[model samples]
Target: MTNFLERLKSPGDLKCLSLGELKQLAAEIRERIVETVSRNGGHLASSLGVVELTIALHRVLETPRDQIVWDVGHQAYAHKLLTGRLDRFDTLRRLNGISGFPRRSESPYDSFGAGHASTSISAALGMAAARDTMGGSEKVVAVIGDGSLTGGLAFEGLNQAGALKKDLIVVLNDNEMSISPNVGALASFLSRKMTSERFVRFRTGTKLLLGRIPRFGPGLLGIVQRAEGSLKGFLTPGKLFEAFGFEYVGPLDGHSLEDLIETLENVKRLKGPVLLHVLTKKGKGYPFAEESPALFHGVGPFDRATGMVKPSRERADTYTTVFGNTLVEMAEKDERIVAITAAMTDGTGLTEFARRFPGRFYDVGIAEQHAVTFAAGLSCRGLRPVVAIYSTFLQRAYDNILSDVCLQNLPIAFALDRGGLVGEDGPTHHGAFDLSFLRPMPNLAFMVPRNEEELRRAMVTAISHDGPFMFRYPRARSEGLPLNGTPEPVPIGRGETLRGGVDGVIFAVGSMIREALAAAERLEMEGIRLGVVDPRFVKPLDRELLVGAARRAALVVTVEENVLQGGFGSAVMELLEEEGLMARMLRIGLPDRYIEHGSRSELHAACGLDADGIARRIRKVVGADTPVACTPRARFTRG
Candidate 1:
């Protein structure tokens, strides 16, 4: 048979296929996904689980005209293939290639951009409202996973949509997993809804018996419908949804192609807000993914046959492992020490923390805002809470971090992981903005570690501190540095001078310190003497070091992995302006624009943050004889 997937140019092509052809297409999509993701390594289990669901949606709805907003976009592999992007599928998650998540800019078929969780229903509701206003009769659907429901935003979106009573379809894809296993009240409720044997038996039996009546069958069905609320309250778990003003449908099998198509077709004809509960397996097609969905959720390149990740190059320890291990050790000694995460137990390396100190570990389930405030509440009772979350996800809790934690001067420490350009996941996952956003806030101490040892030291400093303290580290591994047996607290707002120079001074922070040092070595080849300083704290702005460096060197350069605006560079620039320094300044960091998905090396080179780029730029700014260039690169000039 000719490959149906090859002919599938668009959703319009999908509509022309038979049910059997559609199943074959689904199989082909799964194979292509397994092949591509085996090499590229992305959200494998989630995408494989949603093959049938994706096909059913595209077949039922006229996409582009009709919008489908996918939550998190973790399961968008099949959607990407169906929406005229199959040829470019090989480039998924590569530098300047197709994104792993849905990007509105990339395609009109992608109704909304999603990288973060629990935003799809809101986006879809907004689209539905816009359609009503414009007198457009387009259908809008939001496919959300059960994991997203743990976050309060999904309910907020549900509440608003329910009250508005708009024609919106919210498909609840309940796969019983979310990176880690699903937890909390909502997960239990959904589980009850999915596994209620009594409800299933009663509902099926009632429908069958009613249809058997010759003359009074239609009237009997109407009578049963009228009494459904009272009758279903005892048997079904949909009463909760009924309270929210959404017409609840299903507990349907997400893998059943025929059932999904028929159900979706019928649901499209119905009125107000509808919540269709779908049951699916996370890694539906593949056995290895089915066995350990969490491991394969977002993986590196792996063996397709054996399902083992390709052996990584020998390197130093990752920042996540160091942070997790150190925290466990600290928590063992201090009874007040507690750990919290937002459904990233494994990703954040908190699996051991959860194992060793289960009583102290809290997995808040994709809720960053709740995690912060919860940590603050813990702090109020004299418990020291360490909230470890990815840098990008932490942005969701900015207001909470400021108002609840910072304003009250709580002693909750934030261990921000993936604190720089997290390659492949792209702009949404990058922790570039944490320093920029947190810098202006009062009563908060920010620290970035240069290596594993420094990470341990910073962790110690944060724990010993009395108020809100944050320590950020990159996604990359440590520089194979050794850790001292015991962690020592470094003085707050202090910086270490790695090298001294008379020509120019380079003030680097965190991950940039290594690159800055390399850049200095390259500059020396051209007889350009450049100094390197690791200003450990971004918030406190190492005043004495900045003033002294400015006084000693004719040219001053600030380097960081964060963006220029309101970041480490901005803090230095403010200090230089305040101290009345006559030294020339250049800030090297991420540009004003949002960076695209790529490797860290690719992004670093593109942003001129790599060693070679830094060396070239430093030499350009500070010539052998002259102090400052007559005309500086417009982008690097902070002022």
Candidate 2:
């Protein structure tokens, strides 16, 4: 009912408001988010948690000049409001409104466009180093949540930040949460130290005073540091970060504006790569958010007052749910089955599996690289490791996935969630390149399930089968069939012909499988014999099935939600060339252009990966033979 947020224009206006006014502003912001996101679903919990912190940052730091890089920029809703984007705030994550994360094109204040985690510290340090190199006076700050700290990149940045010892401000927003509750021993230690304000003050003051004084400072500080390390080990946790050469400071209350401001100011003035740990509660102000922060992490449309999420009417089962439920069933049957998620137990559909089998479940917080190696280690021993992760995020650990898992031929099931156009989350979130990247890897078997039944079957086959195996699924729901299928073991490196035809065979991956099937049915109606093949594994090439299909069909069309270059289509083209089958080849996928924010259907239609688009491609290939009523617009726009 109130438009108080509209009244306040800039950070300067926000600065003039008193503490009480700021609290009211927080409420207003939440109200606006609920109103907007309920109508247009976006990240709820993360944005909600950062409200006060966002206000404090704007109030303390000069914007557009002082670069602040937010790690995994989903929680930048408040940051957006304070910037010049409040006017267009109504159209968040729409066709052409505003983005969910920070974008360079969106506004000047957004220092970097980030949807991935564990990048803030590294990126911010880069900006800081550049500023120093150019002899600039702008401040460089990185706001990273605790969950993101699980990422090795953050540690690599921390190590560099410490070694470089440049004036870099790395603020750890310790909400004891980031997507999921902070896990691992390091998270627990940081969280404990965060609440221990008295201890932090004592250690920092001693270090600053002792580390200074020029001549004897190094020797004296060294002795004192060693002494403190031993003394603190008894009183506090081990100092893994201090050894990294960072001036680690408090686990201050992030929610308390006064404390946050005071601590930030204290660290701001300090020089030579300082680390300030600010403790805050995720979904602090709102009760529902406070109670179930994970649910609110990146939420959809919901009933604001009651904090009730709107149930989807589509009734289709998402690929994630299919994977998750299938995993639980497999784990129940076999004791060797274990699951791993990179801080996405809830997102990856492993929550039920986690609940059912606590010991087997491993939620490696925001650390894709670690999750891969960890799974590899599990595989080395006799245990089956299933690393379930989003496609885009999984790319962060490409080297690890290739070298550790694939090269070694570890029997790990990579359940790729949101494998295609993820919709609204934009280019950063889309798992578009999985098929292309994974297809080339050695000892790897990749599959894309058309429906819930295949998704379950793939997981079941992966669990029992040896060597590295992966299967991708979409962000949308399942086939509403409750994963009904005979538990048929997946024939590795084999393609199944969904519909038989002599005209052409459409080889589609994951989400495209459904569309390819639909296209087959459409052609069938017109008395055109079109064949559909769901190539279960990409790496192996399904030689027997594919060769037989190609021999019979006049054309081979490969459909995937990835780039044409080095993508599934590229693989198919390579295979055809190798086999000496110069049949007409058609590729369908996301364009070369970086996809913008839009709904799933909108993005699919635009990219021409939908059923209609798939059919058009099929028609183009087979249409050449017969007079099919169609006009050919370039279905794919090259990047």
RMSD of 2: 6.1
> How much lDDT does candidate 2 score?
0.80
Q: Model 1, 1-639: lDDT tens per residue?
A: 879999877788877899889999989999999999999989999999999999999998998899999999989999999988999999999997899999989999999999999998899999999999999999999999989989899999999999999999999998883322232233334434433455556766888899889999878987887786655454345688878888777666788887777777777866789888787898888999999999989998999899999876857779898898898888888999999999999999999999998999999998999999999999999999999999999999999999999999988899999998999999889999999999888999999888999999999999999999999999987777877688999898998899988788899999999899999998887888888998899978789987887777878899999989989988887777666555578899999999999888899999999999889888877664457422323344343
lDDT: worst 10-residue window of model 1 = 177-186
Could you estimate the TM-score for every candidate? 0.91, 0.87
lDDT of 2 by residue, 245-338 (tens): 8766655556667666655655666668877666677777678888998988888888877889989998776678777777887788889988
Candidate 1 clashes between residue pairs 3 or more apart in a chain or in different chains: none
| TM-score, cand. 1 vs. native | 0.91
